[model samples]
Target: MTLTAVMSAPPVTVAPDVPLSEAARLMAEADVGCLPVVAADGSLLGVVTDRDLTVRWLASGADPSAEVAAVMSAPAVTVRADHTVDHAYRLFRRTGVRRLPVVRGGRPVGMLSVDDLLIDALRRFADLLGPVSGSILHDDTEQGFRSPGPRTVDTNGPESPVVGDVMSRALVAVGADASFQEVTDLLQHWRTGSVPVLSGDGRVVGVVSEADLLRAQDERAAEDPARLTARRLMTAPAVTVHPDTAPSDAARLIVDRGLRRLPVIDTEDRLVGSVHRGDLLAAAGRHATDLADRVRFALLAAVHPDAFSQLSVRADDGLVVLDGRLPRGIGADEVAHLIRSVPGVREVDVTARPSGPAEVHGDS
Candidate 1:
């Protein structure tokens, strides 16, 4: 499929002369991470993202009244609306950008995002699985056997790590009435981009970020900065997750929502901790290492000790690679299948040669 088939059309665009605060407001209103900065004629100029606002503008202490051009990533990497989804995928992989502006005739027409591709893939997968699933249910019914509904993961189990496992229990939060100075101090002290704003009942009500503060500062330039309160600056109805939430799910939420952090709440909806993008990444790395260890252990049990010793196992981001020699009667595909059966193994690569002794050459 082409980008036109899946991309969001008439994407929210910003003009170069738009104020930084206005760009940020547009993003918040559209619930988008980035906006394509277009020329008056609707030609693509650059792209600005939430990160640009935070790092280039807020962190750098740049004036909030600065134009979007000042912080936007110029000469943006773009894709054609007619380009194949595969081409877009390659651009994403090469550029390491989560979103791309789709252009036609050098004019921004749409926007393509990794999330859009993922959703398309999932829809295709569901289409392929639907018939098989229906067949299974039909056979089960005909056999007078009740098919159990979908199985849910037991988060309490050791196999699956939850948000509680990786979230920072030491949380820095602010009351709804916290002064702007107090919020800034807390953010600086905690070294976090944002902090959860809690209500009088200690329930998370919103989030206040550096971008928010900058916007507030610019909008209320006449007012005393110190008089601004968290409630007035916070993004209301904060997106949150529970302690039992899966780390992968939390990461997805953070990325999809372009959020720097998610407040971890308990049954009472009271903030207990927070999980940041970095925290999820560190956890994922650790999980990949642990999975590698598990793959090695499983290989050791499945193969001869000598062969297992000769094999090398490595994993990164859930892709496991096994290389070396396997004993006679063992096939690479067999080993790959074994590895694939392991939970959390997204993919497996096996390159093994049958073990054999070096032959002595006879005099010719």
Candidate 2:
């Protein structure tokens, strides 16, 4: 289960002193999105992905001859080669990064990717089918195990949908001192309802909504508009959601506070992304594979590993079937209700038992 068993070792790498163009050519040759930037001694320096090349270099018009270190994302997020796949899955969900450098003793050893996880998962599922195939075909209760009835997607549940699961990663934020004209132009360009206002240190200080701008224009004369800045028009002490916040609670806050947009902040209250009402609703229809990962991570995050250790999850069409045992004193219905709130989970059918040996429940 450790990364050592699955990671692709002796990964392709690039030197920090290499030109950005050379890095791009290497990536193309290797057919990979990223390359670990390493020092002469083979120590990990940082990582440069296609996104870094596109966003920090090409999009910004940086010279192709610039060093790779100039554009690489530093303090690279990594995992130990001995860590479990579950640990790697947590990193993938929490950091929202597609590739992670697998290291040992502070040196890059291999690469772990989402595609790698998927292949491993498929192999595991294939292995499982060999043992259960007979029981499935000759089941005495086959007639009673008919298809589930039509069920609407459930949104109101105790389980929280983490804001990180649904927040927009492509952020369009403005500085507190940005001119009103600049703010309006950005809003129109991004077509977002509001822009999170950030301080020089990147912490969110306020938010400027379309309503705030309209109110400012309506209440003030045209001559005074030129004097306005984001600091002047934004609503301070902004209402925001943490990346771990449940979408239901966020939605409730939006409705009760009449908010069109909620800024997503990290532990340091730095602006990371924004979530709107539509994002919450649209999340219910995310790709099945993504939803499966989200549900798995959510369960792993909220419930103790011992509780979900034996858990096996399969996405049937849009329904998530959770098969395993619940922690002692936990009810199957509770687990099922929790699974229903995960994005893209149209329905949940739990076939789990209490911690101790007992009669297995068919489904809940």
Best by lDDT: 1
Please, what are the lDDT tens digits per residue for candidate 2 over residues 1-364? 6788778878899999898777877775665667999989888888998667645664354676799989898878888877667667656766778789998887889998855664444333332112221111112263432211112224684443355788988778999888767876776677555788989999888888655654454333345545788988887767777766645555555555555577877768787888876565434334223666667645644433434677787886779988876665457887788778776779888887677553222111
lDDT of 1 by residue, 288-351 (tens): 4378766754553353233465678888888998878775446788888888877789998887
Give me the displacement of residue 364 in model 1, in angstroms.
Answer: 61
**RMSD, every candidate, angstroms:** 13.7, 18.1
Question: By TM-score, who's the top model here?
Answer: 1
The lDDT, on a scale of 0 to 1, for candidate 1 is 0.70
Write down the TM-score of every candidate: 0.55, 0.42
The global C-alpha lDDT for each of the candidates, from Candidate 1 onward, is: 0.70, 0.66
